[model samples]
Target: MVQPLSDERAPLEGVIEISTGALRGETRDGVARYLGVPYSAAPFGDRRFRLPAPVEPWEGVRDATAFGPTAPQSPYAGALGELLPTVAIPGDEILHVNIWAPSDAAGAPYPVMVWMHGGSLKHGSNALPGYDGATFARDGVVFVSVNYRLGAEGFSVLGGAPLNLGLHDQLAALRWVQAEIAAFGGDPRRVTVFGQSAGGATVAALAASPVAGEVMRQALVMSGPLEAKDPADAGRITALIARELGVEATRDAFAAVDPDRLVAAQAKVLAGSSPLGGGPAYAVAIDDDLVPVSPGDGLSAGASSNVPLVIGTTTEEYRLWLVPSGAVDRITRLHLAIGRRAAKISAAAVRRYRANRPGAKHGEVFGAILTDVLLRRSEYRAADARAAAGAPTWVYEFAWRSPVRELGAAHAVELGFVFDGLAGADSVALAGASAPQSLAAEMHGAWVAFATTGDPGWPKWSTERTVRVFGGAGGGATVVPAPRLDELQELGG
Candidate 1:
């Protein structure tokens, strides 16, 4: 139970009763916010590495004014820290949900959008200022942001433990929304689950998950990696981490390791590896029950056929990693060789990328290539699969180049525009002060439209392969045939 606020601030919004109990949400700028509402019990001690359990009922109104404890994570040091500022309020109740609703939404059912944050499934929290859902709430949507376990606590495939505990946390939160969001003026049947990076991948997994079972009506994946580590690869990662901790790769041994030490060891093991190698080292493990097959294959095989999807990636998604880590200038022929081998692309494909971007540096070329293989190609595969399954799919490419450091439409750049929060400090830092407001309005509107009506004002992705491009000279959006399809196909295969 949350301690009642002691400050003498004026009473904000009146209380509303939910399934668990009554909550008095604070009001801000015409939106009523119920922050830090626990959706699941604390995952610690015996519950560590186990599936999430339901939150127990509480007496009296609980205070939902402040942000809850963030999932324990290491700080985002150096360039990553500056680029992606994350808050680490260590606590056990990390599996919580925050809500933003229109003040006048009591009498009507609003389309619900549940946001899952991205941190490579390692580091991130919903408390980030950029994730504020007030704008969505004010726009007649019930917006929810959720927190789940991260890193070892969330993703480690321990013996005698459930796989994808973080994902299970997400599923539990969605169930909570279904059972409780109506009290907050949300339509449970119209839920749209959208996420970026790891969260985006989770959106894909949830769509393919048999256990999810109609929890979401639509899904939007932004720069989500579409592949999961092979079970053998996951075993290797588990063994490596276990060795680092000097413990057996089992639930009992890992649960005994200090969470802080375990996180540090996880970081140390991943350090100095290539982006592709590092990300998959801690990626979603393909499990028989949670994820029977890879999202791409499952979608192709008609999983989640009834759920419409809006999925795409930024034009320069890799710059987010390459530029920040200074890997852009450090690429060598050896690195390119490894990248080519991993992507299984031919020399002609490499030449095509180089020829397409004249005067590009080696690192830039390599970054672009990695971006296509790691991100764009996955999106294409998923989109293609959905199209083939006769499911409605809309594809987009964020092309708005940030004026700051030529970060040209890199990964996570489209987030601010999607949330209509270009003015946020984090967004401005990456997108520059002159980032287009009109473009944000358009992109945000499209997302809202998709959530409300399952259409983002574009033709479905079919054999024609049409895509909506957001960000041009005057910040206007245009539908054009997908670019570089031949090269992307070669890279994807």
Candidate 2:
């Protein structure tokens, strides 16, 4: 039998009662335990492939002790499971949200931060050890992490189904926060949406969305921005994959297959076909109603929110993707493809990239090229758009090198440090044996400050002002030359 939950957890909007559940936590100061509270009901059955329908109200307090099952994902079937624990639900209708906040009774609202996890829109889980919100809660912010549709379940395009259903799921979560966060000691008016990679790109899309603007107040994007695959391209990709499964492109055919079988088929199709790599399958699609247009197009057209923004990318970002493992060859091939796709790189810039690293091998250039093609140029462009849109923006580059062998400030490295929880399981790679307490303090404090106030204790990025070079000499910050920025700007242009 489910035990009765404490009433200390209040209902958001003064209408929905939020029940309490237990949480496991440990921060720099010490260890502390808390609870996971549900703001909405589990999405299931008829709601699959549609917007997150409102969860039916429950009469008695419900137990939110454990995290809800993760949205479904392709099972790579390996030690990856031990590394990343995903709570898999069988249905395509998977929308669940989890919140971790200080349990102590509060009379006032606290600042809110909603996190969107990243998996190239294919795989990610809110239950990852790295994403635990206890540290953020202990740090005095009401933290919420979300689970949206993933892989084909969320991204697949069908005429009747909601395009960009994943995005809609995010919007639903934000709406919940706006209506109910106050009951959990969170200030809805001061909410900030942030994410990494796909998550970051989602935030950028939200910034461009009129509906998301009404719900969100600010944003922090790490390594992403708005831009879904073209609809025709997405449809063609879906068709090709559907054909592989002996299923038609119609919704009825898709609905007939088990979610696991569908995911397995998707993984098979992705392995054999280089869709996004150019054969035609695309992960994100232009859902005009949800996304309207590509994020790049939206920014250029001045269709973005004017909220404060904080955007940053790590220094050795490429190195993360080109580890010494089996990734070297794949990295090289992807880089060659990037060189082919690059439409704006001047011959001079290409020469410069090569000349700067005269002793480097084709492998290194390939990795760097991929970084420039996918992350660097996109990031620079997003900053440019934010400045153009008249939003208060701050752009920083995390240049801190890692003590680890080759994962220098790798993907998701800054996460735990920024949350002030560099002691978590996934964070072990970042903190090292002798973790940089001071640097973590500086970084964490800046994020907390940003969540508290509109500013991050730094000058804002403007069209006139370009980039902030974090971890410069004298342990301070510096600005990049405008001409250099202009040169990078040409890539995105």
Candidate 3:
């Protein structure tokens, strides 16, 4: 599937036509790669808080090697910089897409995977290391990673600005795919949208959005579910944050301010955290026009129940965020503050977790319990809700521990593995030199399979059955975690 880069296959010299205008991209690794491909017009100036407008067609091919400047974002440090260069192109036109495809020049259709990066809606870009689409393209898929509004730019709920502008950016990208994918050797009819973390959450929103009907047919939401701040509550939080910015609590007034200044105010808000303790005060509002209401509710109500779904979480989904190197000893402290158990701590809930690892340390128990409570429970909730609505849904738990940090299958660890980009330092260190080759093959293959066909080679999950457990010796199985899910959800997580 790896086609040699050729003159004929490269984007027409200085004039490859995109939906908006002509673009010129550089060729690399036997693939014609296009960077900074605008999917939506600049969401700045007066357009700052409005729904994305169609980008004006340009007079000539625009260079797309460097990615556009990221939508006003604050760096969410994790190893992202080492994983991908934090090179920011100075521009307000940040909503863009990157494409990588084979180079045979033939005008044939290929499967497409539109990827959304995970950063809790605060920070991340499509132009990251582990996300490079060369491998997927080599594997015969047209790969696209997108940059939507992030943090305040994408998720801050301003009244005058379009709610869910990040989601709107995604829709714009999908519209571009429908209009111009054929030029990149992609099939408009066979598109699969996939994402992790907040990106996964966005995918969930898209699944439930009516506008998404003609945008994508299949979706894979990795490690994100339909649970979070209620849209109405989210709006209230944004208005409160806006008040902190000394701006009137109205969208029009907020939109009149500079995007960078608004972003800085948002950063201050995130830094301040919420006195109410709901994490940062930024995310898509239910916006009756764009998001209607709860995306999970919509999914369960049969709005997008027909869309094929592949959803899963890591075994220790929250371990990355919970048990940090400097924080193991802090578990007992948190437990004391939040109480060791949920509500009044009924005997049944205690028995559910305590009975399994009888001799485990308090910290271990807390970490495990926290992982189940916050992460896995939400994933199960989403899967169960969708399945109940008649949507074909697959659920999974990635239990492959990182060999390097011994981080016990923590958050974002499965990303490189699922993308088949585990040769890097963190991934190789955790997965080992060879790591679990079969696990990567199985997981990545399943992703590709889901993209190619609606089915991902697993039975659909339901209240009676769940499928896909990437755990055990080499870590790959398709089975139900019914008891674990029931136990975790019962804890009121």
TM-scores of all models?
0.95, 0.85, 0.87
Alpha-carbon deviation at 127 in model 3, angstroms:
1.1
As for candidate 1, its clashing pairs are none
User: For each predicted model, how many residue pairs clash, with residues at least 3 apart or on different chains?
Assistant: 0, 5, 4
Residue 456 of candidate 2: its Cα lDDT?
Answer: 78
**Which portions of model 3 miss their true places by more than 4 Å?**
1-15, 77-87, 105-107, 236-240, 272-277, 333-347, 361-364, 373-375, 385-389, 425-434, 462-464, 477-483
Q: After superposition, how far is residue 9 of candidate 2 from its true place, in Å?
A: 15
Question: In order, what lDDT does every prediction score?
Answer: 0.84, 0.65, 0.71
Top candidate (TM-score): 1
By lDDT, the better pick of 1 and 3 is 1
Taking every candidate in turn, the Cα RMSD to the unseen true structure, in Å, is 2.8, 4.5, 4.5
User: Tens digit of lDDT per residue, candidate 2, span 1-493?
Assistant: 1333357755422123443332232223321222234444554456556666776554444455566667767643343333334455443324666677665545347788899998767778777777887767777788888888777777787656667778878888898888877766788998989898788888878877777667788888887745666777767656866888887776667767777788877777766332123344445677657777777567546665467778877655665545523354564535654664564455555555556667765566555555656666766666676677776778777666666655665555677667666677667755355556666677777777888887877677776665666554435445664323433543543
Q: Write the per-residue lDDT of candidate 1 for residues 426-456, one digit (tens) a residue.
A: 7987888788889999999999999888898
Ranking by TM-score: 1, 3, 2
The true-versus-predicted C-alpha distance at residue 106 of model 3, in Å, is 5.5
